[model samples]
Target: MTEMSVQLEQIAVRAARGVGDALRAAFVQAQQPSHKRDHHDLVTEHDERTEQVLRAELLDAWPDSAVLGEEGGASGDGAVHWLVDPIDGTANFALGLPFFAVSIGAVANDQLVAGVVYDVMRDTAFSANLHGAYADGEPLRSTGPATDAQNMLITSYPGPGTLAAGRGVEEYTTLLREFGAVRRMGSTALALAYVAAGAGCAYAYGIHPWDVAAGALIVQQAGGRYLPLPDTGRPWEAPGYLAVNGDFDLPGSCLTDLLPRMLPRTATGTPLPGGGLRNRP
Candidate 1:
């Protein structure tokens, strides 16, 4: 990590650890859950409190940076914006599950430069900046070559009906069957963090900017690659994303072929919007 990246990472790590600390304290006593407008979506008092802690810590550390969080809404207009999901898997957390996580990232000039994902239950923190990615302070990197069909694949289904919600489900289904095994962890940020730690080989989902901003930066720093998912003709928005280990070559991987079929396309074979895809929870 360069000097700047190290400094920025420290700021992000402190904020993330603070979120974890709050979660530990607030959740230990049990939580009162409330459903979001969406029936399947859930939140808790802890979520709001954790966001409050994170926002204050981040804002205090970098007052000029804007903050876009799931809880407190968006604030500021700095060149560098911080995107956070106070608890990425609130549904799981509310149900006494340990899959929930705190996700935070710094975006500057439309690029994600640093991020942190803290898993409260395990006290594990995943972080990254221009320097690289880490799991509990241990440097992380994607494992093996990307072509192995036996590689682990992580996806987020949210609810039962959403699996087929995107483009070319049939192709994705085929890919799933071919891979070693598939995991639907419900938490986009944590799933991506696992990928960054080499706990999984690949991960993809229809994710919002807040959900992925941090993890994506971690993946890149950990020697992985990600970009907007190809549009499937639904809408031209910040497309969902597909990511793979940095060592994985598209030429020999199934993803290279699958990407074209899944991306949104025009009647004349033109691609749709490649940026600004945000799915608000």
Candidate 2:
């Protein structure tokens, strides 16, 4: 890792640990919840507090790096940036479910170089940079393709109607039917981490930069592929995202074949592994 990447890694680790401590405190306190932008999307006191902790830690390490957080608005616009989801799966957390997480990703000049997705309930930290991805300190890699009978797909549920409301929903539904099994886990960061750890084969849905930033780095460093959502055409920010294991083949691979078949094909043509034609950062 470069010195910058190393320094960023330390920041991620510290933030993850701090956020985990915060979540534990919240769970113990049994805090009340509030709504954000809508009722289905929830937030908590801990979420805001955690973001404050992250903002301080992140900006201290990368003074010039832009920071865009779920709770707080964007700050700085340097070539390097920090994208954060202080509390992913807040609905689950508020309901006493255990799938919530804090996701943080670092992007340099539009390219993602590192990220960390910390599962507070489980205390499992998934992180990666240019060097490689690790899960709880052990080097991690993506799972190989499953046999036709074993394939599994994971999803996030804003609600039952959310998917059908989008043009991408039709494609998403078609894949849901084709896959051997489907699961709605309510947490995008954790869903991507499962893909990195080989617990699931692929994941696709609309997600914010904060939701996938850390998980994207984990997926890439784990030897997986992150195909950008075609609509936005940007890496650090996009309306939708897909992540799959690298061991899977391309062209006819589970992800490549499934994505275009479900969502409308991009006007620019299909999105490629690691976002083709679009330059990397």
Best by TM-score: 2
Poorly placed runs, candidate 1 (over 4 Å)? 28-30, 157-169, 201-205, 230-237, 260-281
Each prediction's whole-model lDDT (CA): 0.70, 0.74
Off by over 4 Å in 2: 76-79, 157-177, 231-233, 249-258, 264-281
Q: How many residue pairs clash in all the candidates, one count each?
A: 10, 1
Error of 2 at 186 (Å): 0.9
- Poorest lDDT segment (10 consecutive residues) of candidate 1: 272-281
lDDT of 2 by residue, 1-281 (tens): 35577567668877877768758768766758998778888888888888888888888777777789998889876777888998889898888888888898888756777888898988988988778888887899997664423566776533445445555555556656666777888888998888899765555555688988888778878987676665354554765666667665444434555554454334336554454324422
State model 2's lDDT.
Answer: 0.74
Relative to the true structure, candidate 2 has a C-alpha RMSD (angstroms) of 4.3
**Number of colliding residue pairs in model 2:** 1
Query: What's the residue-level lDDT of 229 in candidate 1?
Result: 52
Per-residue lDDT for 1-281 in model 1, tens only?
A: 25656666779888888667667666656667998877678888888888888888888888777888887899876776888899998878877777888898887655567888888788988998887899888998866445547566676523344344545567668678767667777788887787776654544544677888788788878987665454443211243666666665545555555555554444214342333222111
**Pairs in steric clash, model 1:** 1-131, 229-240, 230-263, 230-264, 231-263, 231-264, 232-264, 233-264, 238-276, 238-277
